[model samples]
Target: MKNVLFIAVFLCSSFLRAQEGTNMKRVIVPPEIVKLAFEKEYPGKTPVWSEEYVGDDNDEIRYEAKYDVNKTTKALAIYDNLGNLKAYEMQISLSQLPPKAQSYLKKNYPAKAIKEIAVVVDDKNKTTYEVGIEKDSRFYDVVFDKNGGFDVIIEKN
Candidate 1:
């Protein structure tokens, strides 16, 4: 099967990683568990792969599977190093968001234009919308509940 071949290749790559240790640079090919999870959840979708390292020293790495949900929406799911699903984000527009989310953004950030809108679905499938705004050379990801309640703001430099 194709999955089998994929897993074999992944294992080979991982063995190389284990031998070389963490100092290895360049993009990592994810283990089989990640591909299996992606297949089970999004059967018909083909994901374009990418990943990033988190933590102060970049000690932790997460894999991403990005795909399109529809003509207008682009979606991506994040997986932990062991291939557990963490969250999903869908790029959307204010008009595509739930009414409550749209209203909340309008009321709170009245003067600021939303640079990007994303619907974030956690592992439990709980959905939240994040509105992004760029101001003062910083990017802000403002989280809002489905009903448009304020959640939190994550500022990135």
Candidate 2:
């Protein structure tokens, strides 16, 4: 029928348009450049490095780099594998955290310094933020529910 043929043509055109929109040029960053930047940022701190190769369902490949600044501290840097810095973050403290998060830190980890904070959204569309703390050479990971209430606390000595 003409109606069925028209529907098929419309679906095919839409699919092609969607694919074209998602076709972006691959970005590459060289390892040497990343290394130089890392050194420049951390001056006297030498990095202990490790890397892993990852590929997406779309066949896009990337490299994940991890740098251990010290026995108790680390940094994560992601690249397209050609060495472009896709993302980078340095491990830091609670004082450098946002004001909304500071209140929770002061109340729960009075004597501890928050080393990391991660915000994650689950499949159910619920959002949770996790805070990691360090106290007396021990690490603690605490998760706060969507409402900012304490969910779970994990401690590692």
Candidate 3:
């Protein structure tokens, strides 16, 4: 009787652990969204690679599609399975920033050095580019917003 009770308890514990492991909260992306993004990003070619619901169960549901135009290169796109474009980044050999932005930085901080730069595009189609510079043992964060048509510059003292 003692041995039987111990075995039953062990089985119950194992079953509970298994259930907990399987209960992962994950976002569900519809198939239509994936199809639309793929079509928009790649017009003539079919997707060479596709993945649905990547990442852990607790992570957001994202669909990734890749297409290859040549043997050594490929293009990649990531979209929410529900058709929302989260973010897409591509590497380029050259920088294609505006001349005005370059002149502004050069004129204002001639002695300063650029530390980092980042561009963020929100869901509402708004774009913000941030430029970080370091000068005289201080850090500056400059932000340029596309929709607002304004520049916000902050200096850490």
Candidate 4:
């Protein structure tokens, strides 16, 4: 469900536009309203920014903010052009996973080293945990419900 968002809002508060024809991406400078919104929401923190198109016509853009939440935790917060928070993802330690999730990983993916662990909270406030691991050189994302029940698995290559 790759719903994680938030990262790319401040490294350069400039707009990036893809050149119409060739394979090159053009970097253009423009007023970034999203950066203003982000600053208001998260004062004292500068974030890296990226733009994404959403909606039926792909005409809407969302801004994502990526930054370190703490010395050990990396976090992302996604927002709409209007500054509405769309989702959040935060890195966490394995011990933070629910006990059932921990057991499931140990039993089903024994001896496999975990690559990443994170928790995602959507605009609706629904939460889920995502665990990344590698097997046979293929990376996978295992998603679990907030309570530790299995949700789904996605092959991420």
Candidate-wise lDDT, in order: 0.64, 0.48, 0.47, 0.64
Candidate 2 lDDT over 1-157, as tens digits, reads 4332222222212221222343232333347866676556557665444343333343544333445557764554444545554444345455544555667768767653765565443323445555766777775666566566676666643
What would the per-residue lDDT of candidate 3 be over residues 1-157, giving only the tens digit for each residue?
Answer: 4332222222212221222343232333348857776687667766533334334353555554444545643344456657766444222111333455666676777634775554444444445555656787776655556432337666743
Displacement of residue 104 (Cα, Å) in model 3 is 0.3
Best by lDDT: 4
Whole-model lDDT, model 1 = 0.64
lDDT of 1 by residue, 1-157 (tens): 4332222222222221222253243445678989888889889998766666554576767787767688766777778777888777777778877787777777767546567677776666666777766677665777777677776676643
Instruction: Please estimate how well model 4 matches the true structure, expressed as its whole-model Cα lDDT.
Output: 0.64
What order do you get sorting by TM-score, best first?
A: 4, 1, 2, 3
Model with the higher TM-score, candidate 3 or 4: 4
Instruction: Give the top-scoring candidate (TM-score).
Output: 4
lDDT of 3 at 32: 80
Q: What is the TM-score of each candidate against the true structure?
A: 0.69, 0.38, 0.38, 0.73
Q: How many collisions per candidate?
A: 0, 3, 0, 10
Looking at model 3, the pairs that clash are none
Clashing pairs in 1: none
